[model samples]
Target: MTNGGWFNHYDDPDEFWDDEPLPIERTPLNPSPSPSPPQNPSSPPQKVVPTPKPVEPQPWTTGPVSKSAGAERLQSGVGSSFVAVQVDAGLLPVHVQLSPQWHRHVDGSEAGAELMRAYQKAIGIYLGETIKSGKYFSGEFRHPSAPPDRRTVLMLLLETASWADYRETQTRIYARNGFEVHGQAQIQNEPVTSMRANWFQVKSIRIWPDWARRADPIQIVDEVLCCANRVRELRPTFKIRGDYSRYSDEDLEYQHLQHRENLIEELGV
Candidate 1:
């Protein structure tokens, strides 16, 4: 029974011709290219960080300065009345008042009395006692009792020069003495350089007069007479214009008109 044809097939070691049928052959799995090991992620292309830009600086400006760099020490409010004038006219005596900034002496002494006496003398000279000329001079010392600590404001006239020049000199004097330039007036035909002159007269001398009396007609006449005499002394031969009418009582009234006319002549305005 063991060799009888495929002994009931089940018992046959090799049934039919060789195996049931030839087994199919499989192709080699082409090693999927090893997936390139993910290329090590290429270090994420070295996250190139961008460079920062530079900032520029700006310029700094300063505000207004409170005080002048080299201002002089003055007797406080007294600076307001420190009037100076340059005149073609000769030296003329006049009165002046002391600045309020002058402190009174603590002790009543002879020296103080002497100072007061000198101040009185100055006043007398200003009031035409020393001035024989028709020109009038008048001023009063503010602190006659305390002359030791007081500053004086003198009123003097100049003789023989043009008024224009005189006015300029006066302005320069006060300017050098810490007085600010307030205003300037120009006069035609009277080109005096002195602040006392019409051309360069200060519009308003902002001083609180210690002597509260308004300059009266008598005082004016005396001043004019003294001024005229001063003019004679300055130039014995040259005629001096002693006419007060020539100078306007109010310099502001026609200052602009005068300045404009002068400028028009100078710049063909």
Candidate 2:
């Protein structure tokens, strides 16, 4: 064999290829999506509210007042033989009981006068008892020697003057308005009585004794009370029409002192 072509270098072939390294492959990535612009949240709807108002006052109105204790019926008679009279708180006669003996004793013409006398007696007795009970006059007033203080005296005078002025004003108003109310009662087809009243007091009471005598006492009293109540119901409301404004306490006291001095001088006391 030819030595140059046939015989190659075989002793170090594996050792010569052991020093080289291998290459690696990779894929491309997609770009991320742009973030959305920030937005403001809508504000919640708001609630609403409201306001309030005021009140007013009223005026005084007069009407029937409740009767006092033991004021329902007050009766008086003379010796059980004469006539008897029953009256209410205002001393308005409600009933008259005439005995047979009284009717026989009094002449037919004198019956009305005798009944009136009995009514007067009843009023007197009622006033006496009222005074004794300290109801009519509550010891507020005293004799000149034991008079109340100057302030109290002035107050009393002012109150009296105020009441008088009010009464006078009310009277005029009643007259102008024709504020009289009338009520009547009948018994057994006969007219028994007719009552007339104004805002302040009973104006007139006309009774037919002949018809009233025939009716029961209780019935008569009931009729009278009914009439009185009717008058109250029918009484019209009126605005208080008086200059109730009063002088100052100092002025009232000065006037009282002056009056007292004048009285003392005039009486030479």
How well is each residue in 1-269 modelled by candidate 2, as lDDT tens digits? 52232222465533333433344454447756779766556866456755555532211111112122222233233423467876555555566676656545655444445655666666656654554454545553222122244454454443333344534533433342313333356557755655665444455545566755555545554555666666655544333233434766677778766755554466555
Q: Which candidate is the best by TM-score?
A: 2
Where is model 2 more than 4 Å wrong at Cα? 1-82, 94-114, 139-183, 186-191, 195-205, 209-219, 223-269
What are the lDDT scores of the predictions, listed in order? 0.29, 0.49
